[model samples]
Target: MKNLTKKIRSKKLESKVDLTAMVSVSFLLIVFFMVTIDLAKPKGIGLGLPDKNPEWDGKIVCGMGMGDRLVTILLDDNNKLVSYQGLLSYPNEKPKTLSYDANGIRKELHNKKRLIQEYYGDTSRGPIVIIKPSKKCNYKNLIDILDEMAVAKIDTYSIINDFTPEESQLLAAN
Candidate 1:
């Protein structure tokens, strides 16, 4: 009779060890981690368009080897801003070198932005400025042009180059 009583007491004690609290704590921990974790995302500056292959079907126009409706910025051997068909230029005389001041570049960019809006009606289709620097052009001038591009929020840009097929084939072979 004593053995039976002891067995009953042991069984009751075993059943009383509640696992509900442990399960609740585990669930709370899982939720906390989920809330604190950050979702992985791509890191970089976003561009206006997707990447295109070297042999893309798009036609190459303008002196910069880009399609039509592109803004072309040509730099002569003297490093002067000669003509830009896409962006508006000051009347009478052409500026040799753009000032390094941010405000100056911003003002010019704003004017260009307005012109582009009027021409295309969509500013999001950002104007593609092609930089065609003459062989004898100063390297500093190129840097200035790049700076202006950044200030103007002009992202789509390309450099003009003329490579012979034989040269290209040699490069490919290498």
Candidate 2:
């Protein structure tokens, strides 16, 4: 009963936090990262398939050369067009070895383009090309041929990897 006579004291405490500046700093960091990073895009040539046409039914495409004419090109391991021309369904045509200089594939293409314009008329379309890259061909040669294709201004060309028996025999002979 004597403890009931003691007096008691009480104290109060309060705390406050301002989150505006912290949120602003976080938002600024997000924006900075978004602005600084770059996304990578893939690079290379773009190609499409031709609609089924009977004119190409019996033709066997092959060769090595370039220009605004329908030419066939065979890219060998040595990065050379062992044989190139503007017709399919024909025999090897005696595979012509070529250099990468302006006097080689590029020159051949320019000459063929001139001939086509002269004979077929300028109103005629650009040359179509058929590219056959043998299994022994390397990626660099493929790219080089593609670059040649672009430089040759060939509008309709297909990259076919299949090798005909005659082409195989010719390639073996080389």
Candidate 3:
């Protein structure tokens, strides 16, 4: 009976040691995760994301690292796509006018489409149009440009804020 009692005591001791090892492992894992975790908030293009219901398709899509195939449309202080160029030549010059003319937009779109087809052989994957409009741009000009985009059938579009956070804050404070 003494031997039986001793054997039971040894089994209990082994179980306790196993529990201690498991606890130690768990603590180490927790510490490792805490130290290596990334907690920085993600920064985006500052546009508000629409609600997640899939039925709402007007949400402006965002993408990073678009190559030379992108097409950029700039709306100046007057809200016009005055300068239409391939992705490489963006920000080179101010776009020309505020007048609402679909003919010019269609022509530029067709030209860009031809260029893409001639160079890369895939005109179906149309260029991604990034519209950078000035804050004071009129609403009518914006609507006209959007209508032109739709007519041109260039669907991937992004409207970016012209000001950085600091500039925006300064403007707001003023």
Q: Which lDDT values do the candidates have, in the order given?
A: 0.56, 0.67, 0.57
Best candidate, lDDT-wise?
2
* Window of ten residues with lowest summed lDDT in model 1: 87-96
List where candidate 1 sits over 4 angstroms from the true fold: 1-68, 86-109, 163-174
User: Can you give the lDDT of residue 119 in candidate 2?
Assistant: 54
Clashes of each: 1, 10, 3
Q: Candidate 3 on 1-174: residue-level lDDT in tens? A: 346554433444444434888899999999888866744445556332322334446544453223434665555444344444443334323333334565577677766666655765664556667766667667776777788778877767778756445333333333
- Candidate 3 at residue 123, lDDT? 49
Give the better candidate number (1 or 2) by TM-score.
2
RMSD of 3: 16.1
lDDT of 3 at 78: 43
Tally clashes: model 3. Answer: 3
C-alpha lDDT (0 to 100) for residue 84 of candidate 3: 40
Write candidate 2's Cα lDDT for 58-140 as tens digits: 44333332232556777888766765554435532445777666788888767666675675565345556677889888998
lDDT per residue as tens, model 1, 56-120: 56644333322324555555445454334433322222322444456454466667667666755
